[model samples]
Target chain A: MSANWRLNVAVLYPELLNLYGDRGNARALERRCQARGIDAEITPVVIGDHWSPDDTDIILVGGGQDREQRRVQSDLHRRGAALRDYIEDDGVVLAVCGGFQLFGQHYRGWDGEIMEGIAIFDAVAAHPGPSIQRCVGNVVAIWEGETVVGFENHGGRTYLNEGQQAFASVVSGFGNNGGDGLEGARRRNAFGTYLHGAVLPKNPRLADRLIALALQRRYGSDAPALSPLDDRAALRAHAEALRAAFSPAESAIGRRFA
Target chain B: MRSLGSGGTALPGLVVERLHDGAAGALAGQLSATALITGTNGKTTSAAMLARILRADDRAVIHNRSGSNLMRGVTASLVEAASLLGTLPRRTTAVFEADEAALSAIAAAAPPSVAVFTNLMRDQLDRYGEIETIARRWTEALGGFPGDATLALNIDDPLIASLESQWSGSSVRYGIEDPDVPPAPEGEIMDAVWDPETQDEFRYTRRYFAQLGRWHTDAGARRPVPQVAADQIDNAEQGVSFTLRFPAGERTLSLPAEGLYSVYNALAAAAAATALGVPPDTICSALESHQAAFGRQEDLLVNQRRVRVLLGKNPSGLNQALRTLQAPGERHHLLILLNDGVADGVDVSWIWDVDWESQAPHCRSVVVGGDRAADMALRLEYAGFPAPRAEVTRDTGEALSRALSGVPEHEQLVILPTYTAMLEVRQRFGRMGASRLWDVA
Candidate 1:
């Protein structure tokens, strides 16, 4: 990595975020870096904001309630070009819940507002309502071999484009449990998920993956190791505790709708 | 871990599921009198106030005193309060703080004799999608009520006032007539106008902040303005107060809460109590004696500093928080705690609509905290305010300490946090304990 490396984390439309505490995402990212002895300078970038895409390393976005999502579409459209440029250069991006939908092709907000997304990851988020699936469980990704436990509350049914596939499969509860079953997208250093409980704190490995991806792009394949030493035992214990507090006996595998 | 079956198994926190599945909807249509106090804002405070009013009348009232209005929360409250046979005790009345969407289900279950619409604002957009949709749902729930049921409506709120036509039952509308309560800020966005003349089938006279300023129109029949028991809603350092107007007479109430909207809330609740056939004295006494519910303009003392809670969920509520901060110039310290969740939907459009760019006092150095802390900070920056003296840390207690310490002992620290963040602030400054409301003093 460069001697003067500063991770630029741009958060989108934080004013409209609701549901689980979304402010946790930015803090979690900051904390992850701090824990690794890395000084991460975070900047808040909003719509109509003019900034150099190269300055940003990690782009973090959060979830919000649906109506707020619709209201923000026009503002987000203003940042369409910059966001596309940031993604094109393999800039690491992280979006959660509503943020995920906002980054994708489009988020069909309630009342059929066709919110034009930045299309960082070719995905269409469909609106689901009347009853939303509140997902809470341990999600073990088969490929990444990393277990992530968090909550997901979205009324959107997402599907990936023809060539795209999900970053991870659900070991439990409707990870892209639609007919298309796209789970979450991780393509070309762009990561998005419906995991809303400050995904980094719950799954530090995922944060490490994003950081590693950013570092690798900046400093070639032989980049300095940036992963925080994993306390798997502690993580496992915490996961078990959360499962105990949230959902137990439900295995890390199921189509259960929390 | 056990199934929700097999002879009433008690899982450590899944009480709501147990009640819903195990009781076979036993709570449905089971109460003698069910009253629901619902709105985006003021539901908890109004419900608590109404509960106090009912309790004053010597009637046993059951409610989620802890502000646990979610499905699990409601069922858990019921389980704790109900008899072993799952039946309410004699002379019982239930005053439920039903969630905006959950209102329909709760109404269907409890079949309330009276439903109060406090007001509607844009909140949890990701969840509810739109204000109109929520308004429609509320109308549906109110319409579902029995013909004889009484609907205590807030006529000042165009959304709530519009529901008058939907209710086939007895309706008593409450609103404020005082023209002095500050006009809706100018430069409001087009969408924020809340135009009553929309081409949409569902339309009403538009007013600012979901508050249309007390109604006097009609639905097929001209209805006189329902007497409001609140006037001269005060929000200065002298403390909040207003007169309670009733058909019998008017008694000025010394309100223990801050904010003009709160006075309107008291007016609405008092009017509702009167509509419910409660005595004027009971309504007047309860309102006079009422204290602020947790985070609903409640005051706290930590290290000899008084911290006031001003929880804002949307542009309307945030505007209220900003507008009500009439304390000009440097002396008063305002601490704002905003998170992504506080915004409640992914939309940041309301940021422009709030007019905080100009409305927020020049001397006020906002302490922004939450998932959207930087967003809030940036907005303030965009609005020409220098960076807040400090961006609050994730630790809400530390943030509170920072804000509280910065303020002089005599001056109050007005805290404006979102729903969950309010709970965090309440837990810190006032020791309200946890989510359970029984222990809060």
Candidate 2:
């Protein structure tokens, strides 16, 4: 990237899709980029707002409640074409929990109402019924040899299509669905996960990887090599989260998922 | 009940319920009157305030003072207060705080003559599902109450005020009417901002922390005028003083509890008391003399240093506690505890939503403790607290000692803990010769 290269981060439907401190992921990306001398601009794209994918380097969509998801469904559909084109061009996108479900093919809510997704990842999420317990508690997963830890609370059971890649293998806690050991979905530069300890603040590697990918997409072969900063606190938090996931009490709770 | 041993808050009630199918309803029916307090936050303190008001009015009040707010806890309190023949004394009044999720069941069992609804915020999604689900449950619960039962609702909270539409009973609407109070910062988690009917974003004319404010939408939805409103709120390090306005008259109440949230609790309790026909002087005096519920801004003295325990279970509550810490002029010594136990909502992600960035720099020394202590420390680190200044000690007792020792002689140490962590701290204090958890008023 050029010396004065700047990254524009578009946070989609922040008023509607913000929950469980998921905006921390956007903060993590911006802070980490700024620490490396990259000027990262975060713009919140609410219901009445629009953003051009050509000008935005990274896009973040957080989780929300069922009502909020319903409110944002139409707005997301309106912007679905541009988001799909951005993903196809290797643009970096991180969608979490409810946002993850909305980025898939479609989500069937508890009342059986279907909400169309952007289909960036060929997946479908369905709520079995209100009678079924939500998939909740600490989660530990392995993503490309790195152990990622977070908390997952969702009623929707997501299933990736045949050609879609699983984001990570769940080591503990329910992920995606209790029936499957896999968690999240990844296609090209687009990633989606049910994890929300704001996920990226603890898992710095995943955050930096997204930043690096955004830089590469913005500047191609001339992209500057990403600089590494001290991640002691983040790594310590990551270790603690992993320990919490495997603790005796949490593990017993995890057995309920079985 | 005390003879049953440690952690017996809910067990005795469970046994009584199993013995008699309608034990709760039967016991509550024996009382002269009963008031039920339910909300996401401020249940314990509000109930305590109302109970004190009733006591000041020369009425015998039985309350679940230990903050065991579940259905079983309500039953336990009733059983403990009943005579050997399973009957309550003459003119005995009951004030019980019900868990937000268990309100319907508790209300049905107790059959309250008055109900108090505090503001609702995003809390324990892993346990409560979503804010809307709980709101729906509360609306259905209100339908089951007798038409004569009065509701003391916080009108500032759009969600709680909206509950009035489903109930036919008279309501005493209370809210903060102080326009000078700081507006809610951008990006704060507003759990109830959208108009459910119109799906239009409600515009706030005056916003406070979280979603408590005077709001209106272009489509004509608006907050109702509160009959009991608070204005000229003066928040100090010692306590909060506010002018409590009601239908009869207005009085200035100075509560020993810290934070504007405590003022809300006082307003809620005052509204309930007013509905129950308590005199304004009695309510004001009772509230002013009201002691903080255990771990809800309760204080302790260890050695020569003062230790204040502030309970912070969710994002909004924690933010308010942090704001309270900022009120004191001097830099503070902090012991922050984050637990993931069942009561603490296993998901620790809510910490990130707290406005720690604004408060971290004001602390002189920081020690994090609990099952998820490292997570709290990391949060402080990200919030720009110097790495070397934050010490992580997972044990609550050890962390308290370290934090207290860090404070200079006669200085105050502030401890912010989640539900289970607060219990752990209280247990340690109990062992150190402080009053036992149940012995406190």
Candidate 3:
């Protein structure tokens, strides 16, 4: 076990990319580390700010509204090479919803305008427009043989390229797009998904996985195994989210005739 | 119109619209000038303030002060004021609060002479997608507004303030200028902050709730455009005395409303009233007489105990509500209702954005209710509230009953609920004979 090691998470574009409590995922990662007695610090990567891979272990970004997404997409373009460099050097990255779309090739906007991305993954997302329903609900997925439960709310239909891998299989809700049966994208230590009950507080396992990956990238093989923490409440919350994900009943008012 | 009985705030409008197509516009045209207040958080309060002032000036106001801010709601209020052939009441002015989602349609169909823009905050993400979507949509819609129309805006919100350039009509911008407020304290989670002025990345000198960073334009100057601002504010627990400053002059007035957000609403209403040419003295008096809309810091008695209902439909609103409930050393009997009704925004995940931890310690006993009650209870548990102490249920009536059961007479119970849930909770209070207006609440 490594005697002393600290993990620094660079939450990219937190101010603009926050949607559906995605910031909670960052908090989840922090709490998991605290529960395990691992040293960790979360630094927000707001607009016009830069992060160093040397001090950063994990890069996390969440979803945002379309216009904000475009803004973040532009800022991300400025840091494209730095992000790629961070990933190339083995820094762990986590992106969700709009962030997931932006981390890929690019996203087609609701207006049919093209909003470019950093293309960290060989993928692209397109909003099918307001005519089609936004995939929004509690959704469960099977990831690395465990159930991953969270919430999904997005209009963009993300399609992975030939070589990209899916992060998980949709167990209940819409995955990427409703037709794909797949959710998010994965490659090495970088992960992206639509599961945002902030994705971590309920799916503590994924939070631990990200934390462990950050630790491994920092401490290498000497990283100690994280002690199991009590997650009964989180699991219950996950169960509730899974139940909600399975139910597609729309509110009487929000429902649109599909 | 007086025979709605209860919960029928929007029915008359719907009936009128059904009987006469384009009734919203036809009826609006008959008034001296119509005004529509729209935004995420302060719609009801702002609409109430404006309506009260207009009515105070002997300008009969046709308004929906019952918290129904939809097209049907506004149309119903107008319907009640108009004749069978659609002639509006003489000297009557239409003052309505339009929902953010319904604003574009409302503006396009019946462009009010005075359209006020209250600050936009993250609200009902499931219902609105993102607040920017509504902002962009409003900008496009307003670009086509009648040239005679006047837009009153909140320059404090970067998103709403950014839309000033879109309006070809006359406009007034309003905001809070107190350094003491410190911009409401940024919540645990934030999603928007970029310098609208310089187009440079924005950094907050002091963060506030929802990262409603000091609004700046692309050039990096706060209030770059002239705006009607609250020049000086002296705040208190239950009310505030503020000096309102506009291009014309400054008038100090007091409102019984609580929170900096309520003050922003007052500023917005004041700006709108001034734009409509209502005298400053009249505006001040109306504000003094203004009562907060139901469920907006509304205190009522139920089952012989005092209760306060604070409406919270989204993350920022809920966070602000919780923040207001937190007294340094005081505890509370809290009934939190989370519904996924369309009005409530089905994406319950936004609850995670709320700083429940800050309010957890202040809860003596929590009763979590509504459609998403279980999820809310789980959130409270995760927020560090003792799991065993909180009573959780989906039945609003049962939950409120449980919450109010053992409370002593001295302790006031607090009820915080989402939009639809607020309606349902109020209905339950009505059924239980706990509402002040037992038959109509």
Top TM-score: which candidate number? 2
Q: What is the lDDT of residue B364 in candidate 1?
A: 54
Instruction: Write the residue-wise lDDT of candidate 3 on B1-441 in tens digits.
Output: 011124547777778778877877777777788888988778888888898888888888888756778878877787777777768768887887888778877776567889988767777776676665776778766876778989898776666766777776679877766666655553466545654334564455545566554654345455444467875676666677888877777889888866677778888888998898888888888898776666888777777778889998777777777777776887888888888766677678888878888887988877777777767776787688755344454577778878888588757888898887777776776666665423334
Q: List where candidate 3 sits over 4 angstroms from the true fold.
A: A1-6, A47-50, A70-91, A110-119, A129-132, A214-223, A251-258, B1-5, B186-192, B195-214, B217-221, B224-228, B245-250, B386-388, B435-441
> Compared with the true structure, what per-residue lDDT tens digits does model 1 show for residues A83-180?
78877789898887787888889867546767778888788887765566444333434337656655565567788888876877665556654454
Tens-place lDDT digits, model 3, residues A55-139: 7898889987776786766678888888888888878988988888888998897788988888888899998888888887667
Chain A TM-score, cand. 1: 0.83
Query: Which candidate do you rate higher for DockQ, 2 or 3?
Result: 2
Q: In model 2, where do residues sit more than 4 Å from their true spots?
A: A255-258, B1-8, B388-393, B435-441
Separately for all candidates shown, the number of backbone clashes (residues 3 or more apart, or on different chains) is 21, 2, 17
With a 3 Å backbone cut-off (N, CA, C), the pairs that clash in candidate 2 are: A1-A223, A1-A224
DockQ of each: 0.04, 0.81, 0.53
* Superposition error at B419 for model 2 (Å): 0.6
Error of 1 at B317 (Å): 1.3
Runs with alpha carbons beyond 4 Å of true place in candidate 1: A1-258, B1-16, B19-30, B83-89, B189-211, B214-224, B227-235, B247-249, B341-352, B362-364, B430-441
Q: How well does candidate 2 score on lDDT at residue B35? A: 94
Which candidate, 1 or 3, would have the higher lDDT against the true structure?
A: 3
lDDT accuracy of residue B295 in candidate 2: 78
